[model samples]
Target: MTAVETPELDAALAAAEARCARQGATLTPLRRQVLRLVLEAGQPVGAYTLLERLKERRGPAAPPTVYRALDFLLEQGLIHRLERLNAFLPCIGPEEEPCGHGCGHDHPHQFLICTRCGATAEIADHDVAHALTAAADRLGFRPSRATVEVEGICARCA
Candidate 1:
Protein backbone atom coordinates (compact mmCIF):
# COMPACT_ATOMS: atom_id res chain seq x y z
CA MET A 1 0.00 0.00 0.00
CA THR A 2 1.09 3.55 -0.65
CA ALA A 3 1.96 5.65 2.38
CA VAL A 4 0.30 8.94 3.10
CA GLU A 5 2.60 11.92 2.83
CA THR A 6 1.76 14.28 5.61
CA PRO A 7 3.38 17.69 5.86
CA GLU A 8 4.94 16.64 9.14
CA LEU A 9 6.64 13.65 7.56
CA ASP A 10 8.02 15.70 4.69
CA ALA A 11 9.42 18.28 7.06
CA ALA A 12 10.80 15.59 9.34
CA LEU A 13 12.62 13.79 6.51
CA ALA A 14 14.20 17.00 5.31
CA ALA A 15 15.23 17.95 8.81
CA ALA A 16 16.67 14.52 9.47
CA GLU A 17 18.72 14.70 6.30
CA ALA A 18 20.08 18.06 7.28
CA ARG A 19 20.84 16.89 10.81
CA CYS A 20 22.65 13.81 9.56
CA ALA A 21 24.76 15.93 7.24
CA ARG A 22 25.72 18.31 10.03
CA GLN A 23 26.62 15.42 12.32
CA GLY A 24 28.74 13.75 9.61
CA ALA A 25 26.55 10.69 9.79
CA THR A 26 25.57 9.31 6.40
CA LEU A 27 22.21 7.97 7.59
CA THR A 28 23.32 5.02 5.53
CA PRO A 29 21.10 3.28 3.03
CA LEU A 30 20.23 0.54 5.48
CA ARG A 31 19.40 2.96 8.22
CA ARG A 32 17.27 5.01 5.84
CA GLN A 33 15.51 1.87 4.68
CA VAL A 34 14.62 0.87 8.22
CA LEU A 35 13.52 4.38 9.09
CA ARG A 36 11.31 4.58 6.05
CA LEU A 37 9.67 1.36 7.10
CA VAL A 38 8.92 2.77 10.53
CA LEU A 39 7.55 5.99 9.04
CA GLU A 40 5.42 4.16 6.50
CA ALA A 41 4.06 1.72 9.03
CA GLY A 42 2.04 4.55 10.68
CA GLN A 43 2.15 2.83 14.04
CA PRO A 44 4.58 1.83 16.72
CA VAL A 45 6.78 -0.91 15.29
CA GLY A 46 8.60 -3.50 17.37
CA ALA A 47 12.30 -4.18 16.93
CA TYR A 48 11.74 -7.71 15.71
CA THR A 49 9.36 -6.44 13.07
CA LEU A 50 11.97 -3.96 11.95
CA LEU A 51 14.51 -6.76 11.82
CA GLU A 52 12.24 -8.80 9.62
CA ARG A 53 11.79 -5.92 7.18
CA LEU A 54 15.51 -5.30 7.10
CA LYS A 55 16.19 -8.93 6.37
CA GLU A 56 13.73 -8.84 3.53
CA ARG A 57 15.49 -5.87 1.99
CA ARG A 58 19.13 -6.84 2.47
CA GLY A 59 19.19 -10.60 2.77
CA PRO A 60 20.33 -11.00 6.43
CA ALA A 61 20.89 -8.76 9.43
CA ALA A 62 21.53 -9.11 13.16
CA PRO A 63 19.19 -7.85 15.84
CA PRO A 64 21.91 -5.64 17.26
CA THR A 65 22.15 -3.70 14.00
CA VAL A 66 18.47 -2.86 14.07
CA TYR A 67 18.69 -1.97 17.75
CA ARG A 68 21.69 0.22 17.15
CA ALA A 69 19.98 2.10 14.33
CA LEU A 70 16.92 2.63 16.51
CA ASP A 71 19.12 3.93 19.28
CA PHE A 72 20.82 6.42 17.01
CA LEU A 73 17.50 7.56 15.60
CA LEU A 74 16.05 8.08 19.08
CA GLU A 75 19.17 9.87 20.27
CA GLN A 76 18.98 12.27 17.35
CA GLY A 77 15.32 13.00 18.08
CA LEU A 78 14.33 11.57 14.73
CA ILE A 79 11.85 9.39 16.59
CA HIS A 80 10.33 9.05 20.03
CA ARG A 81 10.36 6.10 22.37
CA LEU A 82 6.87 5.01 23.38
CA GLU A 83 7.42 3.85 26.92
CA ARG A 84 4.06 2.12 27.37
CA LEU A 85 4.23 0.07 24.18
CA ASN A 86 7.98 -0.57 24.17
CA ALA A 87 8.08 0.18 20.46
CA PHE A 88 9.30 2.95 18.17
CA LEU A 89 7.34 5.39 16.01
CA PRO A 90 8.59 8.25 13.87
CA CYS A 91 8.31 11.71 15.35
CA ILE A 92 5.41 13.48 13.68
CA GLY A 93 6.43 16.93 14.80
CA PRO A 94 8.85 19.32 13.23
CA GLU A 95 12.44 18.14 12.97
CA GLU A 96 14.96 19.17 15.68
CA GLU A 97 12.06 20.69 17.59
CA PRO A 98 12.66 19.62 21.14
CA CYS A 99 9.80 18.93 23.53
CA GLY A 100 9.48 17.69 27.15
CA HIS A 101 12.71 19.43 27.98
CA GLY A 102 13.90 23.01 27.82
CA CYS A 103 12.49 23.33 24.32
CA GLY A 104 10.21 26.30 23.74
CA HIS A 105 7.08 24.89 22.25
CA ASP A 106 3.94 26.36 23.80
CA HIS A 107 1.92 23.18 23.57
CA PRO A 108 3.44 19.77 23.30
CA HIS A 109 1.25 17.15 21.68
CA GLN A 110 -0.39 14.17 23.30
CA PHE A 111 -0.90 10.84 21.62
CA LEU A 112 -4.27 9.14 21.41
CA ILE A 113 -3.18 5.53 20.99
CA CYS A 114 -5.43 2.70 19.95
CA THR A 115 -4.59 -0.39 21.94
CA ARG A 116 -6.19 -2.78 19.50
CA CYS A 117 -4.73 -1.53 16.22
CA GLY A 118 -1.71 0.42 17.46
CA ALA A 119 -2.92 3.51 15.65
CA THR A 120 -1.71 6.79 17.15
CA ALA A 121 -3.15 10.24 16.62
CA GLU A 122 -1.72 13.51 17.79
CA ILE A 123 -3.83 15.89 19.86
CA ALA A 124 -2.67 19.48 20.09
CA ASP A 125 -5.30 21.54 21.78
CA HIS A 126 -4.81 24.64 23.89
CA ASP A 127 -7.49 23.75 26.41
CA VAL A 128 -5.77 20.50 27.33
CA ALA A 129 -2.42 22.20 27.74
CA HIS A 130 -3.90 24.93 29.89
CA ALA A 131 -5.61 22.42 32.14
CA LEU A 132 -2.47 20.33 32.50
CA THR A 133 -0.39 23.33 33.38
CA ALA A 134 -2.99 24.53 35.85
CA ALA A 135 -3.11 21.15 37.53
CA ALA A 136 0.65 20.92 37.68
CA ASP A 137 0.85 24.38 39.16
CA ARG A 138 -1.53 23.38 41.94
CA LEU A 139 0.71 20.46 42.78
CA GLY A 140 3.84 22.61 42.42
CA PHE A 141 5.09 20.08 39.90
CA ARG A 142 7.22 21.78 37.30
CA PRO A 143 6.96 19.87 34.08
CA SER A 144 9.98 20.06 31.84
CA ARG A 145 8.21 18.20 29.07
CA ALA A 146 4.52 17.89 28.46
CA THR A 147 3.61 14.58 26.86
CA VAL A 148 0.10 13.39 27.48
CA GLU A 149 -0.59 10.03 25.93
CA VAL A 150 -4.02 8.47 26.43
CA GLU A 151 -4.13 4.77 25.61
CA GLY A 152 -7.46 3.05 24.98
CA ILE A 153 -9.73 1.86 22.21
CA CYS A 154 -10.14 4.31 19.34
CA ALA A 155 -13.57 4.93 17.78
CA ARG A 156 -13.12 2.21 15.19
CA CYS A 157 -11.97 -0.31 17.74
CA ALA A 158 -14.57 0.65 20.30
Candidate 2:
Protein backbone atom coordinates (compact mmCIF):
# COMPACT_ATOMS: atom_id res chain seq x y z
CA MET A 1 0.00 0.00 0.00
CA THR A 2 1.18 3.52 -0.72
CA ALA A 3 2.18 5.52 2.30
CA VAL A 4 -0.10 8.35 3.37
CA GLU A 5 0.79 11.07 5.82
CA THR A 6 -1.44 14.10 5.81
CA PRO A 7 -2.98 16.58 8.18
CA GLU A 8 -6.30 14.82 7.70
CA LEU A 9 -4.86 11.51 8.80
CA ASP A 10 -3.15 13.09 11.80
CA ALA A 11 -6.38 14.75 12.83
CA ALA A 12 -8.29 11.52 12.39
CA LEU A 13 -5.78 9.63 14.50
CA ALA A 14 -6.00 12.17 17.26
CA ALA A 15 -9.78 12.12 17.23
CA ALA A 16 -9.86 8.36 17.25
CA GLU A 17 -7.53 8.26 20.22
CA ALA A 18 -9.63 10.78 22.10
CA ARG A 19 -12.83 8.93 21.33
CA CYS A 20 -11.32 5.66 22.48
CA ALA A 21 -10.24 7.24 25.71
CA ARG A 22 -13.74 8.58 26.29
CA GLN A 23 -15.20 5.12 25.69
CA GLY A 24 -12.72 3.44 28.05
CA ALA A 25 -11.25 1.57 25.11
CA THR A 26 -7.48 1.49 24.71
CA LEU A 27 -6.37 2.16 21.18
CA THR A 28 -3.10 0.33 21.41
CA PRO A 29 -0.21 0.97 19.06
CA LEU A 30 -1.06 -2.00 16.88
CA ARG A 31 -4.70 -1.06 16.69
CA ARG A 32 -3.80 2.53 15.90
CA GLN A 33 -1.47 1.41 13.17
CA VAL A 34 -4.18 -0.78 11.69
CA LEU A 35 -6.62 2.10 11.77
CA ARG A 36 -4.07 4.29 10.01
CA LEU A 37 -3.72 1.74 7.27
CA VAL A 38 -7.47 1.60 6.81
CA LEU A 39 -7.78 5.37 6.69
CA GLU A 40 -4.90 5.78 4.28
CA ALA A 41 -6.40 3.24 1.94
CA GLY A 42 -9.26 5.63 1.14
CA GLN A 43 -11.34 2.72 -0.06
CA PRO A 44 -12.47 -0.71 1.02
CA VAL A 45 -9.33 -2.70 1.85
CA GLY A 46 -9.32 -6.40 2.58
CA ALA A 47 -7.69 -7.96 5.62
CA TYR A 48 -5.03 -9.78 3.69
CA THR A 49 -4.09 -6.58 1.93
CA LEU A 50 -3.68 -4.91 5.30
CA LEU A 51 -1.62 -7.82 6.54
CA GLU A 52 0.72 -7.58 3.59
CA ARG A 53 1.16 -3.88 4.19
CA LEU A 54 1.91 -4.47 7.84
CA LYS A 55 4.42 -7.14 6.95
CA GLU A 56 6.20 -4.72 4.66
CA ARG A 57 6.70 -2.38 7.56
CA ARG A 58 7.01 -4.71 10.56
CA GLY A 59 9.06 -7.56 9.15
CA PRO A 60 6.49 -10.20 10.04
CA ALA A 61 2.93 -9.96 11.30
CA ALA A 62 0.67 -12.90 11.93
CA PRO A 63 -2.84 -13.08 10.56
CA PRO A 64 -4.28 -13.45 14.06
CA THR A 65 -2.62 -10.24 15.13
CA VAL A 66 -4.15 -8.33 12.23
CA TYR A 67 -7.52 -9.97 12.81
CA ARG A 68 -7.48 -9.07 16.48
CA ALA A 69 -6.68 -5.46 15.61
CA LEU A 70 -9.53 -5.43 13.10
CA ASP A 71 -11.92 -6.85 15.70
CA PHE A 72 -10.92 -4.16 18.15
CA LEU A 73 -11.42 -1.45 15.52
CA LEU A 74 -14.86 -2.78 14.65
CA GLU A 75 -15.92 -3.03 18.27
CA GLN A 76 -14.83 0.52 18.85
CA GLY A 77 -16.64 1.66 15.70
CA LEU A 78 -13.40 3.12 14.40
CA ILE A 79 -13.77 1.11 11.21
CA HIS A 80 -16.54 -0.67 9.32
CA ARG A 81 -16.51 -3.99 7.52
CA LEU A 82 -18.01 -4.09 4.07
CA GLU A 83 -19.70 -7.50 4.19
CA ARG A 84 -20.14 -7.94 0.47
CA LEU A 85 -16.50 -7.15 -0.25
CA ASN A 86 -15.03 -8.59 2.93
CA ALA A 87 -13.11 -5.35 3.25
CA PHE A 88 -12.87 -2.49 5.72
CA LEU A 89 -13.24 1.29 5.65
CA PRO A 90 -12.39 3.72 8.40
CA CYS A 91 -15.23 5.53 10.09
CA ILE A 92 -15.53 9.26 9.53
CA GLY A 93 -14.02 10.21 12.88
CA PRO A 94 -15.81 12.36 15.43
CA GLU A 95 -13.89 15.39 14.24
CA GLU A 96 -16.46 15.74 11.47
CA GLU A 97 -20.10 16.16 12.35
CA PRO A 98 -23.40 15.50 10.54
CA CYS A 99 -21.90 12.46 8.81
CA GLY A 100 -21.04 14.03 5.50
CA HIS A 101 -19.93 10.63 4.24
CA GLY A 102 -22.56 8.56 6.04
CA CYS A 103 -19.81 6.52 7.79
CA GLY A 104 -19.92 8.43 11.01
CA HIS A 105 -19.41 6.35 14.12
CA ASP A 106 -23.08 6.73 15.02
CA HIS A 107 -24.72 7.11 11.63
CA PRO A 108 -26.40 4.47 9.51
CA HIS A 109 -24.12 2.77 6.95
CA GLN A 110 -25.26 2.72 3.33
CA PHE A 111 -22.70 2.34 0.56
CA LEU A 112 -22.57 3.06 -3.15
CA ILE A 113 -19.90 0.76 -4.54
CA CYS A 114 -18.40 1.23 -7.97
CA THR A 115 -18.10 -2.16 -9.57
CA ARG A 116 -15.64 -0.95 -12.18
CA CYS A 117 -13.19 1.06 -10.12
CA GLY A 118 -13.83 -0.52 -6.72
CA ALA A 119 -14.43 2.89 -5.23
CA THR A 120 -17.10 3.26 -2.57
CA ALA A 121 -19.02 6.15 -1.09
CA GLU A 122 -21.09 6.11 2.07
CA ILE A 123 -24.48 7.77 1.98
CA ALA A 124 -27.01 8.72 4.64
CA ASP A 125 -30.68 8.66 3.74
CA HIS A 126 -33.13 8.94 6.59
CA ASP A 127 -36.08 8.23 4.34
CA VAL A 128 -34.62 4.91 3.27
CA ALA A 129 -33.97 3.94 6.85
CA HIS A 130 -37.42 4.98 7.93
CA ALA A 131 -39.06 3.15 5.07
CA LEU A 132 -37.16 -0.03 5.81
CA THR A 133 -37.99 0.16 9.47
CA ALA A 134 -41.65 0.78 8.73
CA ALA A 135 -41.79 -2.13 6.34
CA ALA A 136 -40.18 -4.41 8.88
CA ASP A 137 -42.44 -3.21 11.69
CA ARG A 138 -45.53 -4.03 9.64
CA LEU A 139 -44.33 -7.65 9.73
CA GLY A 140 -43.73 -7.46 13.48
CA PHE A 141 -39.96 -7.63 12.95
CA ARG A 142 -37.50 -5.54 14.88
CA PRO A 143 -34.14 -5.01 13.35
CA SER A 144 -31.10 -4.51 15.50
CA ARG A 145 -29.18 -3.09 12.56
CA ALA A 146 -29.25 -2.74 8.81
CA THR A 147 -26.64 -2.11 6.08
CA VAL A 148 -27.50 -1.30 2.51
CA GLU A 149 -25.01 -1.82 -0.31
CA VAL A 150 -25.67 -0.74 -3.87
CA GLU A 151 -23.26 -1.73 -6.63
CA GLY A 152 -22.96 0.21 -9.87
CA ILE A 153 -20.68 2.37 -11.96
CA CYS A 154 -19.52 5.50 -10.23
CA ALA A 155 -19.84 8.94 -11.78
CA ARG A 156 -16.14 8.96 -12.54
CA CYS A 157 -16.46 5.66 -14.35
CA ALA A 158 -19.55 6.77 -16.21
Candidate 3:
Protein backbone atom coordinates (compact mmCIF):
# COMPACT_ATOMS: atom_id res chain seq x y z
CA MET A 1 0.00 0.00 0.00
CA THR A 2 1.15 3.53 -0.67
CA ALA A 3 2.29 5.25 2.48
CA VAL A 4 0.73 8.50 1.41
CA GLU A 5 -1.47 9.63 -1.45
CA THR A 6 0.42 11.61 -4.08
CA PRO A 7 -0.95 15.14 -4.23
CA GLU A 8 -1.15 15.82 -0.52
CA LEU A 9 2.27 14.41 0.09
CA ASP A 10 3.79 16.47 -2.68
CA ALA A 11 2.24 19.65 -1.32
CA ALA A 12 3.42 18.94 2.20
CA LEU A 13 6.95 18.30 1.04
CA ALA A 14 7.04 21.44 -0.99
CA ALA A 15 5.75 23.51 1.88
CA ALA A 16 8.31 22.00 4.20
CA GLU A 17 11.11 22.79 1.80
CA ALA A 18 9.96 26.39 1.62
CA ARG A 19 9.69 26.69 5.36
CA CYS A 20 13.18 25.34 5.83
CA ALA A 21 14.59 27.76 3.28
CA ARG A 22 12.91 30.66 5.03
CA GLN A 23 14.37 29.59 8.37
CA GLY A 24 17.84 28.93 6.93
CA ALA A 25 17.58 25.26 7.74
CA THR A 26 17.95 22.40 5.31
CA LEU A 27 15.54 19.50 5.26
CA THR A 28 17.89 16.83 4.00
CA PRO A 29 16.81 13.71 2.17
CA LEU A 30 16.91 11.58 5.33
CA ARG A 31 14.82 14.13 7.18
CA ARG A 32 12.33 14.20 4.31
CA GLN A 33 12.00 10.44 4.47
CA VAL A 34 11.28 10.58 8.19
CA LEU A 35 8.73 13.35 7.69
CA ARG A 36 6.96 11.34 5.01
CA LEU A 37 6.67 8.38 7.31
CA VAL A 38 5.16 10.52 10.04
CA LEU A 39 2.67 12.21 7.72
CA GLU A 40 1.58 8.96 6.11
CA ALA A 41 1.11 7.32 9.47
CA GLY A 42 -2.28 9.08 9.76
CA GLN A 43 -1.86 8.99 13.53
CA PRO A 44 0.72 9.45 16.25
CA VAL A 45 3.69 7.12 15.67
CA GLY A 46 6.59 6.20 17.88
CA ALA A 47 10.26 6.67 17.00
CA TYR A 48 10.84 2.97 16.72
CA THR A 49 7.99 2.64 14.26
CA LEU A 50 9.68 5.27 12.13
CA LEU A 51 12.97 3.47 12.36
CA GLU A 52 11.33 0.20 11.41
CA ARG A 53 9.74 1.76 8.37
CA LEU A 54 13.03 3.29 7.37
CA LYS A 55 14.76 -0.06 7.74
CA GLU A 56 12.12 -1.61 5.51
CA ARG A 57 12.94 0.85 2.74
CA ARG A 58 16.63 1.26 3.39
CA GLY A 59 18.86 -1.64 4.38
CA PRO A 60 19.36 -0.71 8.02
CA ALA A 61 18.95 2.49 9.98
CA ALA A 62 20.58 3.47 13.23
CA PRO A 63 18.37 4.52 16.12
CA PRO A 64 20.32 7.74 16.53
CA THR A 65 19.81 8.56 12.87
CA VAL A 66 16.06 8.36 13.28
CA TYR A 67 16.20 10.31 16.53
CA ARG A 68 18.29 13.03 14.95
CA ALA A 69 15.85 13.40 12.11
CA LEU A 70 12.97 13.58 14.53
CA ASP A 71 14.80 16.24 16.48
CA PHE A 72 15.28 18.31 13.37
CA LEU A 73 11.63 17.95 12.42
CA LEU A 74 10.54 18.98 15.90
CA GLU A 75 12.87 21.96 15.82
CA GLN A 76 11.46 23.09 12.51
CA GLY A 77 7.95 22.96 13.90
CA LEU A 78 7.06 20.41 11.25
CA ILE A 79 5.85 17.90 13.83
CA HIS A 80 4.60 17.58 17.39
CA ARG A 81 5.42 15.06 20.08
CA LEU A 82 2.55 13.80 22.19
CA GLU A 83 4.27 13.26 25.53
CA ARG A 84 1.41 11.18 26.89
CA LEU A 85 1.47 8.83 23.91
CA ASN A 86 5.24 8.87 23.43
CA ALA A 87 4.63 9.45 19.72
CA PHE A 88 4.89 12.05 17.03
CA LEU A 89 2.23 13.69 14.89
CA PRO A 90 2.60 16.06 12.00
CA CYS A 91 1.79 19.63 12.87
CA ILE A 92 -1.72 20.50 11.69
CA GLY A 93 -1.04 24.12 10.84
CA PRO A 94 -1.50 25.49 7.34
CA GLU A 95 1.00 24.06 4.89
CA GLU A 96 2.87 27.34 4.35
CA GLU A 97 1.87 29.44 7.33
CA PRO A 98 2.05 29.34 11.11
CA CYS A 99 -1.13 29.15 13.17
CA GLY A 100 -0.62 32.88 13.91
CA HIS A 101 -0.96 32.28 17.63
CA GLY A 102 2.66 33.32 18.37
CA CYS A 103 3.13 30.04 20.22
CA GLY A 104 6.73 30.34 18.98
CA HIS A 105 7.16 26.69 18.09
CA ASP A 106 4.69 24.10 16.85
CA HIS A 107 1.89 26.64 17.20
CA PRO A 108 0.67 26.77 20.81
CA HIS A 109 -1.72 23.91 20.10
CA GLN A 110 -3.61 21.28 22.03
CA PHE A 111 -4.82 17.84 21.10
CA LEU A 112 -8.18 16.20 21.44
CA ILE A 113 -7.29 12.52 21.40
CA CYS A 114 -10.15 10.11 20.89
CA THR A 115 -9.94 7.45 23.53
CA ARG A 116 -11.68 4.83 21.40
CA CYS A 117 -10.40 5.43 17.88
CA GLY A 118 -7.03 7.02 18.76
CA ALA A 119 -7.73 9.78 16.31
CA THR A 120 -6.51 13.27 17.27
CA ALA A 121 -7.63 16.77 16.38
CA GLU A 122 -5.31 19.78 16.81
CA ILE A 123 -6.83 22.93 18.16
CA ALA A 124 -5.37 26.29 19.12
CA ASP A 125 -7.52 28.08 21.64
CA HIS A 126 -6.00 31.39 22.69
CA ASP A 127 -8.33 31.76 25.63
CA VAL A 128 -7.29 28.42 27.04
CA ALA A 129 -3.64 29.37 26.70
CA HIS A 130 -4.22 32.73 28.25
CA ALA A 131 -6.08 31.23 31.14
CA LEU A 132 -3.34 28.75 31.77
CA THR A 133 -0.75 31.48 31.64
CA ALA A 134 -2.76 33.56 34.05
CA ALA A 135 -3.03 30.70 36.50
CA ALA A 136 0.67 29.96 36.23
CA ASP A 137 1.51 33.58 36.89
CA ARG A 138 -0.74 33.59 39.90
CA LEU A 139 1.35 30.74 41.26
CA GLY A 140 4.57 32.61 40.40
CA PHE A 141 5.45 29.98 37.84
CA ARG A 142 6.85 30.78 34.43
CA PRO A 143 6.11 28.31 31.73
CA SER A 144 8.55 28.15 28.88
CA ARG A 145 6.28 25.83 26.97
CA ALA A 146 2.79 24.49 27.40
CA THR A 147 0.97 21.55 25.88
CA VAL A 148 -2.61 20.79 26.78
CA GLU A 149 -3.90 17.39 25.83
CA VAL A 150 -7.50 16.53 26.56
CA GLU A 151 -8.44 12.88 26.30
CA GLY A 152 -12.00 12.02 25.28
CA ILE A 153 -13.92 10.50 22.43
CA CYS A 154 -14.01 12.70 19.39
CA ALA A 155 -17.24 13.57 17.57
CA ARG A 156 -17.04 10.48 15.41
CA CYS A 157 -16.48 8.14 18.31
CA ALA A 158 -18.95 9.95 20.56
lDDT (C-alpha, whole model) for all candidates: 0.71, 0.81, 0.80
Tens-digit lDDT track of model 1 for 68-97: 999877766566667777777775344554
Give per-residue CA lDDT, model 3, range 1-158, as digits (tens): 12345677777777777777889999999999998898899888999999999999877889999999999988888888899899988762334443334232644688888889888877888788999999999999999989999999878777
- Which regions of candidate 2 deviate over 4 angstroms? 1-5, 97-104
Q: Clashes in each model (backbone N, CA, C under 3 Å)?
A: 1, 0, 0
In model 2, pairs of residues that clash are none
After superposition, candidate 3 runs with Cα above 4 Å error: 1-4, 92-95, 98-106
TM-score of 3: 0.90
For each candidate, what TM-score against the reference? 0.68, 0.90, 0.90
Model 1 clashing residue pairs (backbone): 100-145
| Regions of model 1 farther than 4 Å from truth | 5-14, 92-107, 124-146
lDDT of 3 at 40: 91
**Candidate 2 C-alpha lDDT tens digits along 59-85:** 789999999999988877777788999
The weakest ten consecutive residues by lDDT in model 3 span: 95-104
